[model samples]
Target chain A: MLDNPYHNKTLQWLAYAAVFLLIGIVPLLTDDDFLLNQLATYGVYGLLAVSISLCWGSGGILNLGQGIAFGLGAYGMAMTMQMQSQAPGTIPPFMANNALETLPIFWEPFWNTGLGIALALLVPTLFYLIFGGLMFVARVSGPFFAIMTLAILSALATVFVALQPYTNGVNGISPPTGLVIAGTKIDPYSSTAYWLVFALLLICTFTAKLLTQSRFGLVVRALKDDPERVRFLGYNVAVYETLVYALSGLMAAAAGASFAVLTQYVSPAQFEVGFSISAVIWAAIGGRGSLLWAMLGAFTVQGAQSYAGDAFLNTWILILGFSFILVVRFLPGGFAGLAELLLGRLASLRGGRREEFGQAPAKGAAK
Target chain B: MANALILGISIASIFLVAAIGLTIIYGTAGVINMAHGEFIMLGAYATYAMQTYFGLPYFLCIPCAFVIVGAIGFVIEKLLIQYLYHRPLDTLLATWGVSLVLIQGTRLTFGSDPKYIQMPGFLSSNIELGGVSLAAFRIFVILAALALIALVWFVFYKTDFGIKVRAVTQNREMAAAFGINSKQVYSFTFAFGAGLAGVAGALFGVLNIVLPTMGTGYVVQAFLIVVTGGGALMGSAIASIATGEMQSIFAMLLNDSFARFLIFILIVVFLRFRPQGLISAGGSRR
Candidate 1:
């Protein structure tokens, strides 16, 4: 039975590959720009879901501050878009409005997309590197980890709210005019933008899968199971944990950049504690060990909420919360394990009936 | 100066009541009870419903709100929290879900608008001392919170029931072997803690807008208080009042958000130095 576990895993990979190809070709089958826009949004969420899975599922890090990393990414990308859209040789609108005679020194570097993208990865990774390093080194695990991260998020939110000159103070930043990709002007609502988002999602998903299959992945899982044992094995568990955390932050930031491009706006609301909590629910519902399950869980929950409409939107949180409880209670192995269990049961039932009836001349012959 | 002091005391009183209940549960059960804020919301709404719908006098509705909200807490403990006694992480998530349900239910029923519970004629009156006027309700809140604290102290340190509760909190298995019904103690303790939160909520609603999302704001503050206070009932009360007074004074001097940020930074720094907390030395870290 264990020998064929890889067989099921291969089948699962194929199924996910098929879904990815279908989504990639969606714009080709439809002329509806609105549909493509919605799919792009889903792709952004998928990136986030995968990022969350990499950390929480594989790294045993319950980061309730995924939104903070995302906000960093969104703010980074949005700042560049804002700077690029200003009149040639003129300051951005906010600085212009604030009576600043010259462009701020900080805003100067973001004019280059390369710098902005680099910062998007660096900022969140650095934030996590410092914070996660401190906590893990201090031996803060479990609920304390959750609370400390939440405290960091609260601080970030307050900073965002207070720094009106930079963050616009709760109003958040919107992408300025058109998105410039490698000097090519692209409408945020265009199919090209959607395709770009899809490509990024593929890259993130593939990278996450690769990370999970590597030797580092084995060490991380071992740390999760027995931290003392890993320490005894002469591995620097804190460094490994921090590295995985920074990687997760980078992935989250990448997703946030895509989200900013797709939505054309970014706000404090996007990084609220609710968003972070929902990510936890997604990770839990998708099953913690499987990347495919995490993505499927995100798609299922988000798709359900979208289909349920605006009237039910407010109640979507309650639904998600209850779903977390249900998943924890009834499906401890989550949707992925549950699917495998059902399939196995059906196969066993068929074999048993076949033995009872002496195969019954093989119902439905190949010929 | 007198008015500011009075306002500070009133705010501190609210925190004291909320943080005490939170500390009790955290200290004894090692459960953070994130839904404690929701219980406060329930209490506030219960009082609002009583006064507005039942036409009860505001004074009469206070105890009634406590009973109604306390019953809700009891039911929640018996039905949901009991199953999660051995599972802290699951308990946290489940209670979070319960809090969402409560908030959404309130939004659905109350239409998301802030509801006002009119202060009684006595509480609406103000007392003047040396040209400084203080709201009578503020005085009442301070006194009531103090009385509640005194009562809790007596129960916890001066009674057999309190001893059993504390014993179970210290070690459930050992206490059970010693003929203590840990299950019963857990239910009663959770219900009692939740009841205190409810009363805090009802009383606090008078000082602020009673809204569906009001609990969300208090939840973090309560956690900060519980952590800072040392995860014990006395420590939480003292820390909460101190923090509350500090915050109010800071807010009076600086921007409210800035004051909050400073306090949070202080707490984080304090945790770095003494992670076991201010009240409970060697307590299990939640």
Candidate 2:
């Protein structure tokens, strides 16, 4: 079934490694803090896109409220960094500015850096597990699952905006000074921060890619194709889906935590439905079935937006919306699909007999 | 206390109008349109354009908005949605893309500032009964909601088009086999739904600021009603009334934000126990 050019094992791994090599060597080429920070943001977004691809594309779990978990991670680290920035015996600056006398109980645990980071990952994981377990066990799939997550994200954004004293309201809370943990500080606009984000993105991409190549990954692909068939084969469909869903939460939170450290802010706007939907767009543009391409999709779109923000301003999003429609309608495989077509042509041109799987249809390229 | 119930019913009516468009499209065409909100937004924008340019009365703008937005919807379905009748997920993504285009397009045209539609002098006043007090416009909105529900009922049940729509919704191939042009039914149904949303936008423009992004706020609530109602007209009405009342009462006890949060959680939990919703569409995909 894995006879297609997109799933060519050796070539994919090599391409993935080459991209990481290029990413890792960027710092050596430039001392521009602005550029590094921008790239670091891409790496964080890359992690997020990969997670979305893992669950939404591969596992067939359409989670539209992923930004909530992303926000949870951002807030988790921000709470710690916010506490760190305060004077001894005083509340965080945001809370102090809002006239809060004591820290909220939830914010108390985040004062310690370790607990803050741990909770950043742990809390979102638990949330995904419980939420996914509930939905999947009940056999809810497809559009209903997608819409529910969208609703939850929008509801959470409203709640976050309302919790002005705690969430710092619409303007958001920023710990711009960066984070210090165990005597080592991760500066917001430094090579160290960039390297950290870059390294994590690579690790996450590699691990997730490997996971997708495992036996478990095969089941997920099968499940995505036909959940009933997977279930009939004696596989616990809900457990498998819920597990991957929780893993996606972990990855997203990690990215969010890094985002907090790199950007030094967490806002109610980050929890907005648009934020999560854009992540979906990135995954879709990159080809959701391929992790590397999905991350690259984030890099490409976000990079374009960042560069085009000033000149185009209003027209950028209008054009982007149009592009998204075209991609959805015509280019379902996205950049990955384009790459696959080229590879297939190259193979055919060589007058070589391509490995043909007897039972696999051409549509099952990723299988 | 009783005042809250009155307010709740009023809010429920508004939600029902906003969601009816979405429910109709989903029911008749089996589409999950993410651009449903944008269609409603276009409706409000159409109303605003009429008032600002022609100095059209608030009451008269409703039908104008309906026709303008519904025509746009009809054209959109013919051009884009017709190709995606079988793919719900693709339809959603495509509609979302359409929504983005519409939002940005409107923003480009109107700018981001809030616009206002002048209501009649009587609607600007308030109606008071015993201890309860509410805006005359709010009361007007409530009546308008009821009118929309009744109008929709009449269309869906009493007309030949309704039979065609229902036939296609139940079984598309069979409907097609029975000399019913399912495609035409879908386009008309989509246009009708869009018209309803346009009316919703015209009403909502008076209640809130008429901004490009206003549809977003209503859209979530609309989806909540639809999901809770199980994607059927009767179910959507019952769900809207129940959720609206519950939200209002909860807000009375706590706060609006918390009340909304509670409703969201309650819906999620409610769906867990009954994924079919407050009213299931039997074994059909709602």
Candidate 3:
């Protein structure tokens, strides 16, 4: 089942290492803080794309609430930084404006950076565990599961906006500057920040890839193929799915936290249904079943979006929508599949066995 | 209490129109169109274009919107949905792309500015019953919804095409074996569904601001109704009415945002217990 050329274990790890090195050195290669920030943004997006792939591609659960996970991270960190940006003892200005004499109980814990990060990961994971667990145990899958996640995203976005005092309304929570952890101040556009994001991206990618290639991933993929058969084989399918979903939420939260630091803001827009759907598109176009390809696809598509924003005033969305359709319809393997085909052709010309490397024995390739 | 009940029925009427199209498309083709909302958006745009450029009356815009959107749906079904019928997920993704194209394309042409359709003077006024006052437009919406539902019921139950559609929906290969052109039925059914969305859009344009993103707002509710309804006409009708009434009652008791949040939560929990929806069709692919 792992015979796909893109699933070549050594080649994948090498690709992972190579991509990490390339992105890690990008800050050093460029002195422009703007470019560095953009790279950091892409890295954060890469983390998000990898999260989507981990759950949807390998675990057979299409989580469209990924933006909520990402936004929870951003909101968590933003709340911390927003408090930190003010004087030590004063309530957040927004809370004061809302006529509160003191910080809300929820906001009190986020004042600590460590608590912020922990909450970022814990909140989203717990959300996924409850939500995904309920759906999975109820035996919801396929289109029904997909739409339910979308509902979560829309509902979350709305709830964020409606909870004005805590969420700062639709204007969102924006700290004037980057976060301070212990005695270290994080400057968002600085090389250090870029490296931090790059490091997080690397950690997320490697861990996700490792998970998807592991025995647990194999069972998840098998379960995705036929849940009843896996159940017949004595596996608790819902538990495995819930675990992977929660793990994906953890990764998304981490990305979202770092993303807030990079952007210096957290808006309800971050939790928009469109934003979550974009993550799905990135995974789909990257190679839904492959973590490495999905990460690359995020970078590639986001890079194109950034570049296209400058070149085409409004046609970029049209082009993106069209490409998304074309990819789903004609190029189901996405850019990763195209790369695999090219590599396979090259290997075949050099007298290698094409079938073993080029074509996966089954559609579930990563496992 | 009567006022709230009346308000709920009015809200339910609009949702019923929006959800009916979705139910038909999903019930017939088993395609969960992500672009369903976009089609409704296009219908509003069509109405706006007709009223502004062609000087078509607001009442006349309904059929015009329906025909134009239905034609677009026909073209889409022929060009794209036809190929994706075998893959439900692909249909979801591809239709999402279609929605993006529709939304962006509309934005490019019409810009992001909100547009409105001028309702007739009567619809613009209010009627008093006892001590309660209701907008004439809301009553019109309710009557229009009832008319459309009746039309759909008549079409589906009292026509040969309806039988063909039901047959094809139940078993495509068997229907084909019985000399029914399932493909044609699918195309017609898709077009009909799109037409219903167009009418919904036309009505919504008056009820709310008509913008490129308006469809999304309605589409979410439509989805809730359709999903809860289990993709059937009767189911959608009942679900929409129940949801609308509950939303109104919730809003009356709590604030609007909290009410909506509660509804969304309830729907999710409801789905947990009844994933097949309020009613499940037998022989459905489990």
- Computed on alpha carbons, the lDDT of every model, listed in order, comes to 0.78, 0.86, 0.86
Clashing pairs in 2: none
Model 1 misplaced regions, further than 4 Å: A1-9, A96-101, A311-317, A343-367, B1-10, B125-134, B281-286
lDDT, residue B100, model 3: 93
lDDT tens digits by residue: candidate 3, A1-367: 3234555789878987887888777877788998888889988998999998888888777776799889998898888888777776788778778777877788888777788778877898899899989989998888888888888788888888888877788999889878888789988888999988888887788888777778998999897678899999999999998899899999999999999999998999998888888988998999888887898899888999988767995899999999999999888778877888776655445534446566534433332
lDDT of 3 at A349: 50
Q: Top DockQ: which candidate number?
A: 3
lDDT of 2 by residue, A1-367 (tens): 2344555799889999999999999999999998999999999999999999999789978777889789888888888888787766677777878899998888877777788889988998899899889989988888888888887888788788889999888988888567997888887788999989988898888999899999999999899888999999999999999999899989999999899898888898878888999999999898888898999999999999988966898999998899888888888778888888777666544423444433333442542
Q: Model 3, residue A173: what's the lDDT?
A: 88
Model 3 per-residue lDDT tens digits across residues B1-286: 7777878898899889888889889877888888989988999999999999999989899999999999999999998899888878788889999999999999999999999888888789998864668889988999998999899889888999998988898888899999999889999999999998999899888888889988877667788888888887888898989988888888899867777888888999999998878776435654
- Using TM-score as the measure, name the better of candidate 1 and candidate 3: 3
Residue by residue across B18-110, what tens digits does model 2's lDDT show? 899988887667788888888888888899999999999888999999999899899989988888876777788888899999999999999
TM match of model 3 to true structure: 0.95
Alpha carbon deviation, residue A320, candidate 1 (Å): 3.3
Q: Put down candidate 1 lDDT per residue, A1-367, tens digits, no spaces.
A: 2122323657766876987898889888987888788878878877888888888778777777788899889888888788778766887666556567787787788878889878877888898888788778766666666777777677678878887776777888876676687789867677988899889888888777877778998888787667878999999988988888888888889888888877778888766877877777776788766776787788777778788746688777677767776776567557876876666656556665667756433432321
